[model samples]
Target: MALVAFSAVIPLMTVVNYSVQDIFGPGQRYFIGVDWFREALRDPEVHGAFLRQLAFSGIVLAIEIPLGVAVALLLPKAGWKSSLAIVILALPLLIPFNVVGTIWQVYARPEIGFLGRVLNDIGIDFNYTGDAVSAWATIVLMDVWHWTPLVALLAFAGLRSIPDAYYQAARIDGAGRLAVFRFIELPKMKSVLTIAVLLRFMDSFMIYTEPFVVTGGGPGSATTFLSIRLVNMAVGQFDLGPAAAFSLMYFLVILLISYVFYTILQRASAS
Candidate 1:
């Protein structure tokens, strides 16, 4: 209540105020209703950043979800090996997001870095700092390595929750591994997978720090997702009105997408 109001509602009202005003100083401001939004909506560079954000989220979900599910499926059922596997798989998630980016940044340097040197040794020109394609690949790979463990851990929990009776029934039916996965495991995993998708989608959509730290949203503006663009506008350029409007629009987009996912999740659960 009070906490929410102070933290979220108050700040939002301030943004709404800023969105409708051109502010220069503490007391220097003028009302310009809806103008900032119009400018933000019409900006070509903003559109490009939004599209890049969507693409990044799409790629992350495509790779991480399937890889996570497969890894979860292959994990040991029990015993010391299972415990060790869990520990190892969870290691990446333990690293701070910023530090993860720094680690990858160092590892991807074309000179002394292991990944960079291996690629160059193999006659491949891989330079994340200076090449757009390499930059994109490195960032995407970094995200996959960092976040896929989260998805896998969630899926593993879902898999572990199923009753032994279900497996026994599948065995009695002579169900093959694929058939068991599709008919039994898949359906049970659906709820958790839906959650994984939503979490990944929202997080990836707002992704900034790692990519910024690694490539600084560069090799040009090639990796500048919406968050990076928003930061550049709000903080870098000091455009309060436009930045406020953009932030509101950004909040709406996330809300809308999450709502859509929630609708689908509910319907799936109902069916």
Candidate 2:
């Protein structure tokens, strides 16, 4: 608890302090109440970034969850093959985020990268650096490639934990593959899926490094999510006061949504 307070709570309080105060330098500060918060709430850039962040998170969850579940279902149940499958699936999750970004950066360059060269050769004007649609698609693709493995692994665990007796009963009752999955498998994986959604949503919402390295929050702020916007404000603009306020609101939004998800999961588990 003490360590947590020192590591987490102390920095948080410092942010809270900066949020309400206008500080130009050491010994150059003044309390401004909620002025910065009010301005941030009205800021168009913040609103745009918030919407983009939501869209990214939504797209990720949509792509990852079902795909992961399907892959998990298809993975071998028991064998040397199952072990090989698990190892292969876990490879992407093992790569560091910055490294993933750098890899995509090189892999999408039109002059040299295989993907870029192939697309241009096929007469598709695919340039993530110069085009908004391409940027969004590449970022989404990169994120999906890297993180879907985590969902697969989680769903794999949930799938593996189901007792064989359930499948036996389903078979005896003439339950088809679809029926078994819909009624038996899905219900059993609900808790695991809920956790997966929460984790993915939170991670995707706060994603910065990958997109930053890939696009530098561009093709004209098209890929600038909340985290990028916050960094731009805090570091680039050097507006600590407004940046702190934005950070606080960001934290609150995350906390509120997390609580809502937890409550829903609890209610679901109960009945």
Candidate 3:
């Protein structure tokens, strides 16, 4: 409790304090009530970033969840081969976030990077730094590469938990592969899948580092999601009051959507 208070609660209170004040350096601040919040609500940059964030998170979930499950299904059931595959899948996740960004940034370079050079050579005109669509695609692909292993591992654990008796029963009943998966595996993996979805949604929604490093939140404001917008306001522009207000709103948005996700998934699982 003390650690939580010191780590989260105290900093949160400080943000709360800043959110309502118009600060002019140390000891020159004035109370401004809800002015900053009103400004944040009215900001068009905030609106665009929010929409982009939703789209990114939605696309990520749509791709990674199904792909991860598919990968888990394809993995060797039990062997040294399975161990090797697991280690290989997990390697991407072990890389630091900033390093992941740096790697992709270099890897997507138009002149030098293998992916970029190959695409251009094929006459595809794929420059992530110059094109909005390409930038979005790269960010999404980068996230999938970095994080899908996590989902695959979770699904694999769920798969391993199913009893041999269940498989034997399905086999004796002459259930086909698809039917076994649909009736038994899907139901059994529901809880873990729920967790996977929530984790992916939250992480993807708040993503900043990779996109920032790769696209720097643009060719324009094209790749600018909410987190990037917040950072620009807080650090780039140094608008402390509005930034603080925006941060609080950001926290609420994530918390609210997460609760909604959890509740819906729980009800679906229960039914």
Candidate 4:
């Protein structure tokens, strides 16, 4: 109880306090009601960040969920090979977020990084730092590389949980691969896939460290998602009241969307 309060509750309360008041300096503050919230809602920068965040999260979920499932399906079902594959797939998830960013940053360098050098040599005109499209692509690819393993591992667990009886039944029915997957595998994997989708959505929605380290929200604000924008407001500009309000709204958005996802998935599973 005390630990939760100190770590989460207290900080949240502090943000709530700051959200309604204008702080000028030490001990110089005044209550401003909902002015900051209204301003945040009206801010074009916030709007852009919000939209970008949505797009990024949507893209990530679309790519990772399907790709992860395919990878899980393709994995060897057993033996030493299965163990080795699992270990290899788990490697990316074990890497620290900032370290992943740094690695990609160097690895995508046009002159020295292997990826960048190959692309440039192939005449793709790729430069993550100098091009907005390339920047977005790099960030998305980086995210996919770093996080897809999680979804794959989850789906793999879901796959492994199916009983031999189910496969035997499918075989007796003379079911095609697609029919078996649709009728048996997918239905069986729903619970874990639901978890994978929710986890990926929430994490991608709140992502900051890796993208920030890689792009710094550069190339003319092309990748300035909500987290980056909020940090810029609070830390860069020292707009505590507005930043606090923004953060509250941010929290609410995540909560609301996650609830919607859970409800939809629950209803689907039930049906």
Q: What TM-score against the true fold does each predicted structure earn?
A: 0.97, 0.97, 0.96, 0.97
lDDT for 150 in candidate 3 is: 93
Task: Give lDDT tens digits, candidate 1, residues 80-189.
Answer: 99999999999999999899999999998889889988998999999998999899989999999999999999999999999999999999999999999999999999
Error at 253, model 2, angstroms: 0.5
What lDDT score belongs to each candidate, Candidate 1 first?
0.94, 0.94, 0.95, 0.94
TM for candidate 3 is 0.96
- How far off is residue 133 in model 4, in Å? 0.8
For residues 1-271, what per-residue lDDT tens digits would candidate 3 score against the true structure? 9999999999999999999999888899999999999999899999999999999999999999999999999999999999999999999999999999999999988899988899899999999988999899889999999999999999999999999999999999999999999999988888889999999999999999999999999989999999999999999999989999999999999999999989988798779
* Tens digits of lDDT, candidate 4, 143-245: 9999999999999999999999999999999999999899999998898999899999999999999989989997779999999999999999989899999
The clash number for model 2 is 0
For model 1, the stretches where C-alpha displacement exceeds 4 angstroms are: none
Q: Between candidates 2 and 3, name the one with more favorable TM-score.
A: 2
Among all windows of 10 consecutive residues in model 4, the one with the lowest summed lDDT is: 211-220
- The collision pairs in model 3 are none
lDDT of 2 at 147: 91
Error of 3 at 80 (Å): 0.6
